[model samples]
Target: MSRMKIALAGIGKIARDAHVPALMASDAFELVAAVTRHEPPEGARGFRSISEMKAALPDVAAVSICTPPRGRLQLIAEAFDAGLDVMIEKPPAATLSEARQFADMAARAGCVLFVTWHSRAAAAVEPAKEWLRGKEIKRVEVSWKEDIRIWHPGQSWIWEPGLGAFDAGINAFSVLTHILPGALTVEDAELRFPANKDAPIAADIRLAHAHAAPVLAAFDFDQRGPQTWTIDIETDGGRLALSDGASAMSVDGEPVRLDGGPEYHLLYRQFQALLEDRRSDADLRPFELVADCFLLGRRKLVAPFEDF
Candidate 1:
């Protein structure tokens, strides 16, 4: 089969670190162009906008949008208008209403739309899901914390209204929603906002399922030491833990061997499969949980997060 020509819509950190490399290595897709407001990556043909890219590279079949959530709705719409399939990064849009429109727009255009939750593609996620089946789960604890100075650096947009700690917390939510046995609803939440920023810097969220097992999550953007992205589950059988962003797992204190290259690689492979099947995978469970956290959370002012 011929490789599908695709354009990357944003050339930021994730684009450079993950998406571009994945596309270049994929057997099913080819990176033909880039659409960025800033200078594009070296050696790649650059375009000012999706419309311009479509006008120039008429043969580009799909676009992978790597832009921030606030501005992605319009970009996805433009791609659909140009009769192109789209694959967007996590935390799909600024609001649930806008994210909900992506599927409708894709359907109207007869194009494939994939709102990817890349963390769910992690090696341990599926294994943990399989291990938990038929077992009685007693509790779940998620600690997703990282230093903004390290991960985001000078990216001030992280403190924007729709992002912040949940930008990283949502990845844990995505993994939990994928592996858990049932649905979860936010029971209570405490959001710690920096005095100077519009978004929260740390949060404590409590969620519940019908089974009554408590789900506790702690998220922080100000950690100074080693980062943590761990989901520990206490089940009747034993303890199941996914650490290092679900790249590693252990059950009953024994390590589970994992096999995979990178999350983005798995994501593109799934996108290719979706395109082949003419299906759209826009799972909204994780996104909805984040929205609900904001809805039920009480705000507390913390020290001003003035730096990166």
Candidate 2:
């Protein structure tokens, strides 16, 4: 099969850090152009906007959107209407209705629409899932805390209404959704919003599973030291723990390594498979849980956070 001609709609942090590097390394895709307000990187056509790219590079078969979560519906609509497949970053949309809408539009248009949950594609996630296949979980705990200044310095969208705690927390949900044998529903959530920002700076979420005890999660955007992204679970049989956002895991103190590395590369491989199969994979479980966390969770105002 020929390499798919792909363009990037937004060339921000994740795009530079993950998508561009992954595409450069993959034989499945040909990086054709980048649509961004900033100068596009070398080896790809640069356009100030998607409109210009669509007009000039009509042959580009697919596009990966790495923009902020807000104002994505219009972009998705236009891409699908132009007969190009789309791959979206996590928190695909700000609302559940839009998620359903995008999935439906992709299905009706017969274009591959992939919603990537990078954390789910992490090295240890599948192995953890296999390890916990049918074990009865006693309790589950997810802890994700990182410094926003170090990770997203000056990015105003982090403090915006659409994505804050949900941005990072959804990654936790993604890994959890992939590994757990059964489903979970949000029992409740406690969100800590900064007084000056529209989004929350910290989150305490509760989840319920039919076969498991209460699942507790803590997501915070204010951390001073080395980052933490982990999921620890106690099952009826033994204990399982994932560290470094599913990059590594341990079962009863035994270190387990996965077969691969760098989740974005694995994500592109799956995108290639989706295009070849002429199908779309836009699972909404994780996003829906985020929505549920916002809708059903309690909100508390904390001291305002001032980022660098």
Candidate 3:
């Protein structure tokens, strides 16, 4: 079988650290070109933009967009118009409306459009999901905290009004949507924004299912020591814990082991499968939850944070 030639847009940290290595390891995909305003790192083919890359590498079958959420719709639309299957990174777009637009365009174009939730590809996630089947859920709690200076460094887009901790927060929501019993909507939230920025530095969210359970989610980007990404669920059977952002799982008191690698590898594998089956994998639930939280949540101004 011929490999799918793929181009990567927004060759930033995520593209370099996750997508690039995953594509290199996958026999199903060939990294034909990359589009970025910035320079591609060593040993990588570069194009100034996605349009330029499509013009030069017409054989490229797919494009994975790793750009920030604020401007993703136009890029995905352009890719769809070019008849390229598109895979967008998490928090598919800046708003739920844009995500719907992309879904409609992808349908009209008859191409695969995958909204990648990398955390869903965590090795232990599916197993945990399986274990939760038919179990009665009591409550769900998610806490994801990390130091932005350590993780993002000089990235400025995250501080923009439409971006920020919402990106990582959506990832946690994505995993919840995948493993939980059903859909949920935000009931209440408090977003804490740094005095100097447009976006929130932390968020406390409450979510509820139709009649079954309630979920409490907390996200903090200013955490200083021993960063955390954990989800704990209380069920009639026992307690299910997913730590390290779903990369590690434990049930009751027993630990579950998982194959270790960057989450993008499994994501690409699923993307390839979707392409092969002539299917689309665009799920907007996670993004919708975050957007809803922002729309309805109360806002609080917090003291300015600095890296020291």
TM-score for each model: 0.98, 0.97, 0.96
Global CA lDDT computed for model 3: 0.86
Tens-digit per-residue lDDT, 1-308, candidate 2: 77889999888888998999999999999999998887786799998766678899888999999988888898889888888899998779878888889989998888999999999888888889889987998899999999888888789877778669778989998888888877888988999999998999999998986644889999999988999999999998799999998889999988986687788899999999998898899888988888889889899999988887
Runs of candidate 1 with Cα error greater than 4 angstroms are: none
Which candidate gets the maximum TM-score versus the true structure? 1
lDDT of 2 at 3: 85
Q: Residues 1-308, candidate 1, lDDT per residue (tens digit)?
A: 88999999888889999998888789999888999888776656899988898999899999999998887888888999999999999889999999999999999999999999999999999999999998887999999999998888888778888658999999999999988988898999999999999999999999985459999999999998999999999999999999999999999899999888799999999999999999999998898999999999999999887773
At residue 36, what lDDT does model 3 achieve? 84
Q: Over 4 Å off in model 3, which ranges? A: 41-43
Error of 1 at 72 (Å): 1.5
Judge candidate 2 against the unseen true structure and give its global Cα lDDT, from 0 to 1.
0.88
| Candidates by TM-score, descending order | 1, 2, 3
Each prediction's RMSD to truth: 1.0, 1.3, 1.5
lDDT of 1: 0.91
Count: clashes, candidate 3 = 0
